[model samples]
Structures are given as structure tokens and as C-alpha cells.
Target: MTFATFIKNTTQFLFKAGFIFWLILAILELLMPGFVIYYINMQLWLIVVCCLAVARAFLCKEISPPKADAPMAQK
Candidate 1:
């Protein structure tokens, strides 16, 4: 796969993962106090990394179009 596609996919995956992590953490905090507190900092860093990756993906150039030499369907 192309670099742009790889970056885009990676960012998407990370975003989903981060979202799920926070959701779980929220549930845990509601059930128990001080538990999962250590993960707060780590989760924040994950958010930051995901944000940076998304930014990079947006800045990446669009994929090139197919070449004319490729085969075409016959009528």
C-alpha cells in the first residue's frame, strides 16, 4: 500500500482505539475512585499522537491517477 494510505489507515485506527480507551476509563472512574488514574496521562499522550497523525494525513498529497497505458474494457 502507498504511504498516504498507510498513514490514513493508521490514524483512523489510533483514533478509534483512543476513543474506546477513554470510554472504558470513564466507566471505571464512575465505579471506583483513584483507580485508572495512572492511565490518565498515558491516554492524553495517545490523543496527542492521534491528533498529530491526523494532521499529517490531511497534509499528505492525493494519490496519483491511473496511467493511460492500463488496459480498458472493450465494447
Candidate 2:
């Protein structure tokens, strides 16, 4: 595969994996009780995963249009 395709696939994979991890953590939090410290830790982890996912998506090895070029897509 080309470098661009590889980067895209890797980024997508990481994002999906992070989302799934966060979902499982959220479910565990809901099912369990009286674990305030664990809940807070999970929440922090979820935030980190979400941030990493977004960063991976945005910083993938692909070129994006600049602001001037991007405006045309909205029309």
C-alpha cells in the first residue's frame, strides 16, 4: 500500500480502538458502584484516549486544504 493509505488506515484504526476502549470504560463505570477513585481515573483515561484519537485523525499523513480553499466546499 502507498504511504498515504497506510497512514490513513493506521489513524482510523487507532481512533476506533480508542473509542471502543472508552465505551467499555463508560459501561464499567455505570455498572459498578462506590468506586469514585476508579471512576475518576477512567474518566481521565477516556479524555486522553479521545484527545489522542482526534490528534491522530487530524495529523494523519494527508494534506488538507487551507482556509481559502476550504471555503468552497461549504457552498
- TM-score winner among the candidates? 1
Predicted structure 2, TM vs. truth: 0.51
Per-residue lDDT of 1-75 in model 2, one digit per residue for the tens?
999778778777877887787677677666776544454676677677787777786767467566564445554
lDDT per residue, candidate 1, 27-65, as tens digits?
A: 787799778776566567566867856675675546889
Candidate 1 C-alpha RMSD relative to the actual structure: 7.2
Error of 2 at 7 (Å): 2.3
Clashes of 1: 0
Query: Model 2: how far is 28 from its true place, Å?
Result: 1.7
- Stretches of model 2 off by over 4 angstroms after superposition: 34-40, 59-75
